[model samples]
Target: MAGLSSRSAVAIHALAMLANRREGSLTSAEIADSLESNPVMVRRVLGRLRDADLVWSTEGRGGGWSLARPPRNITLYDAYVAVEEGRIFSRHTRPPSGACEVGRNIGDLLDAEFQSAERALEERLDRTTVADLLQRILAADKEPADH
Candidate 1:
């Protein structure tokens, strides 16, 4: 099945890290280190977050990124919309040739399905905040030793 863009996942992970921090911001390098991902890729995702106003960047020696607001104020849907470019699934870019009846009807049918699915997805995401995910992450981190 098709899935959310990896950028959405990275945005969530990066936001969770920020939410977990008690003080100070994390540079792109630090976030990249945590994700074990390329720093450039992390920066790009962070840039998108910044553009969306979900994150704010600081300048200078100790400069880095931080949430624009409290984690609880930011829902997963916010991040998803910011990074997903407003589309859950890719759509037909070019019109189908006037050749087949199925081709004429398929796009509309699939588009309706996609819209319904996207709405449900957004509704669920709206109920989940960055703080909620951070809590889950923290709990998971503590679970191994408890087991």
Candidate 2:
């Protein structure tokens, strides 16, 4: 099945790390290190978060990012939408010269269906806050060692 963009996942992961840190601020390099990705990618995601007002960055030496508000106020939907530029699902071009009735309307029909599904997905995400995600991550980290 189709999935959320990798950028969405990466943004959430970065936010969760910030939420977990008692220090409340982390440099982009540190976030990149934890994500095992490049600092530029982390900064790009952070730039979007900053635009969304979900995160704030400091300048100069010891500069870093911090959540703009409490985790309980941010939803997964917020993080996802902040980075997504186009429609969640894109429609391919029309089929060759409307060869068949089905081909003619298929894109429109699929687009409608996708929009409906996306609405439901967004509603579910709205019910879950970043705080909930952080709790899950923390619980997983605390799981007992397996033999």
Candidate 3:
């Protein structure tokens, strides 16, 4: 299964939290508390998001972080790309040994397949905005308990 990097997930969570509480900015410490993680890690992820223009940070005691734009304008794909270091999926080494005919071509074939899959994932993510995600989460929270 393809799993999101923790940094990517943390960044998204932090931005979504800010979107939900748009009245004011939130410190990395406040975000870390809600995420059950360390403030340093939160700051690191926030730094990446800031570089991506997905979020903005301010300095000083009262300063904190906030989304650069409305949540509806941001997509999960945006968050994913912000923290991705390299190819989403990468081969550890050249695929099979060159001794066999199939071995030499396998890597190319696999690379094409990986690229296609990544494109599809990006398309799907583009259709989903942070606003959509937050709405779904809030809806689930409001569901009546089964007694």
Sorted by lDDT (best first), the order is 1, 2, 3
Query: In angstroms, what RMSD does candidate 2 have relative to the true structure?
Result: 2.2
Q: Best by lDDT, which number? A: 1
TM, every model? 0.87, 0.90, 0.90
lDDT of 2 by residue, 51-109 (tens): 99999999988778999989999999999889877767767643534877877778879
- Candidate 3 lDDT over 1-113, as tens digits, reads 34457987898799889989858799999999999999999999999889999999889988999999999999988998888676676653545778989887787787899
Residue 72 of model 1, lDDT score: 99
Candidate 2 ranges beyond 4 A from true positions: 1-4, 145-147
What TM-score does model 3 achieve against the real structure?
0.90
List residue ranges in candidate 1 displaced over 4 A: 1-3, 91-101, 145-147
Clashing pairs in 1: none
Q: lDDT per model, in order? A: 0.90, 0.87, 0.86
